[model samples]
Each structure stands twice: as C-alpha cells, then as structure tokens.
Target: MTFLPPDPPNQSPAQRKRKKKKRKFPSQSGFWTMMKRKKAVEEPARVCGPSNKVELDPDLRFGLEKAKRQLESLRQDLTQFRDRLISARGSLDRITTEESETLEGVEVVIMRKEQDILGLEFDIHWATDYAAGSRAN
Candidate 1:
C-alpha cells in the first residue's frame, strides 16, 4: 500500500560566497610599536672606565674558607689511606713468603717419610734372603 504526503515549501538559493580574509596578528603590531619605542629612546654611550667591581659577601667568603679546610683534611686522609694500604701490602707479601717456606718444609717431611718406608722394605727383604740361604745351607 502507498501513502501520499503534501509537498513541502521551496527554499531560496544561498548568497554568493565571500573569500575569507587572513586574520591580522596583534604580535606584528606589538613588535612595530616596540621598535618605534626603542627608536625614540636614546641608549647611553659607553665610557672607558674601570669595570664594575662586585664585592663578595662575608658569609660566602667564610664558607669558601671552611670548604677549603675540609678539602685539605680530605686530601690528607686519602694520602694516609694510601700509605697504610702500601704497608698492608708489604706485610701480606712477607706473610706469603713465610707460608711458602712452611709449605716447602712440609713437602720435605713427606719426601723423607717416603724414603724411610722404602728403606725399611729393602732391609726386610735382605733379612728374608739371608734367612732363606742359611736354612738351605
């Protein structure tokens, strides 16, 4: 089934389109104004004279002195540490030398025991041979 509806009112065409103009920035105008103001002001001419001197604060100067003293103390401590380390290394080297000698002594004792055991075995063998010869005779 089809349903019929009443016709809607016709609308008029839109007006001619106008090209959008680019926006003028306020920063350029401000810059030009600042430039004109700077031109109007006269800059002071430089005179040849002694440069401005800055005085150090007394507290800052005292703090710097204290820091220098602390730095010197730290350096001395580092030097002492290095010296002690060298002394300790020397002692360690001596200990190692003594330990090596002690090890050599232990090795010599082990070798001597081995030789004694071999000698006893040889003596026992000779005694057995002598007894066997005496019995055969």
Candidate 2:
C-alpha cells in the first residue's frame, strides 16, 4: 500500500463565491430575536379577582368606633390626672422649702408635714397607672 494522501477535489469559482457570500452574511438566528418574537406574540395578563377586595363586617366597624371613643376618653382622663399630679408636686415642693426663723438667739428649722408629700407621690403613681392603662387599651 502507498503511504501518499489522496488529491483534494477542486471547487468551481461560482461555488467558492457563494460560500464567501454566505460567510459574509451570516444567518439571523440569534436567541434574542427568537425571544423578542415570542414576547411580541404572547404576553402574560395581570388581573385581580373580586376576592382581593376588603370587606369589613358591621360588628367589626362598630367595635372599632367604640374602641376609638374609649381611647379618646382615656387620653382625656390621663391628661387630667397628669395636670393634677403636677400641681400637687409643685405644692409639695413649696412646702418642703427650708424656712429659718431666729427666735431668741435659737435657730428653728420648721419642717412641713409629710402627709402632703405622700399625697403628691400617690397622685404621681396613679397618673402613671392611668397612662399605662390607656396605652394597653
């Protein structure tokens, strides 16, 4: 057997020119073109049904209104309690002021009663409770 390779076939000039033209003008089969055509033909529809609408029951509405009224009343009560507490605290502070009276070369320290101070502290505690209850409601 001969070890030489066979001679290749010679293509005509017309066939070579056609092949060159095909190479120059490549096929228009890109993925984006196909995707654009598909999107142009078929688009997804976005729609909501009647079930999405909100429906509030009459009892719930009434309850909400009642709760709102209660909240308003609680706020007013809390405000009144706070004002009373502040006034009481101010009066107690005034009573606690040191008053020095020199009677016959003897210094006298006149301390006020502790009952008003205790009463003011109690009012402050009650005001805090009123505020907490209002927030909880």
Candidate 3:
C-alpha cells in the first residue's frame, strides 16, 4: 500500500504544470566579504595634525586643567593601592612569623636568650671606660 496523499479535487491547471528552477542571486554580504577580509590585513592610516603652534584658548586651557586633575586623581588612587598592598604584605609577613613562632615554644626560647644575656659578665675594658667617663662628669 502507498503512503502518498490523494490530489485535491479543486486543483488548478497551472498547478499541474512543472515550476521552473529559480536563478539564485549572489548574497550582498558575500560580495563585500573579500573587501572586509582585506581591511583586517591592512593597517589603518594614522591622522597627523599640522605642526604649527596653536594659541591656547580658554576652552583648551579648561580641558588641560581637567585632564591634569584626572591624572592627579589617578596618581592618588595608585598611591592608595600601593599603600594597601604594602599593608597586606606586612600582615602576611606577621602571620607567617606568628605561625613559625608558636606561643609556648617561642616564649621559652626568648626567656632562655634573656637569661644568657643577663648572666654575662661585663667586658673589663668597656666597664673601665664607662667608670672613667662617669668620674669626668
């Protein structure tokens, strides 16, 4: 059994005739595609102004002042950023130092060092110079 549908009873005589193949028109987008590709390969020409000295008007002076203020603001922002970075680095250093020197062990080491320094006999030459200086006073 065929799966094709039956033709409509109201079909026109024009519908019976075979339709001619359409002549495909080239796309407008594709026509400029090569030119668009060449644009990517080519370097854009740089525009240069005349080298003659131009007098600065009030408007130009205002623009220059505005630009200077913006530059100063940016410099301040960079300085603040650097200050924050330095502070962050310092905190990180402190954290690492604190981690390395645990409370119980580090305190014991510090105490031992203090005791050794305190128990040391003063150098004879240095002590004599100090005593002689005190007498001169």
Clashing pairs for predicted structure model 1, backbone only: none
Residue 78 lDDT (model 3): 51
86-128 per-residue lDDT for model 2 (tens digits): 5766743443233212221121111122333345445444444
How many residue pairs clash in each candidate at the backbone level?
A: 0, 0, 0
- Locate the minimum summed-lDDT window of 10 residues in model 2: 104-113
**C-alpha TM-scores of all predictions:** 0.30, 0.28, 0.27
Query: What C-alpha lDDT, on a 0 to 100 scale, does residue 2 get in candidate 3?
Result: 71
The global C-alpha lDDT for each of the candidates, from Candidate 1 onward, is 0.49, 0.44, 0.46
Q: Which clashing pairs does model 3 show?
A: none
Better of 1 and 3 by TM-score: 1
Better by lDDT, candidate 2 or 1: 1
- Candidate 2 structure lDDT: 0.44
List ranges where model 1 is wrong by over 4 Å.
1-95
Candidate 1's displacement at residue 62, Å, is 89
Residue-level error in angstroms, candidate 3, position 25? 48
Of models 1 and 3, which has the larger lDDT?
1
Question: What lDDT is reached at residue 52 by model 2?
Answer: 34
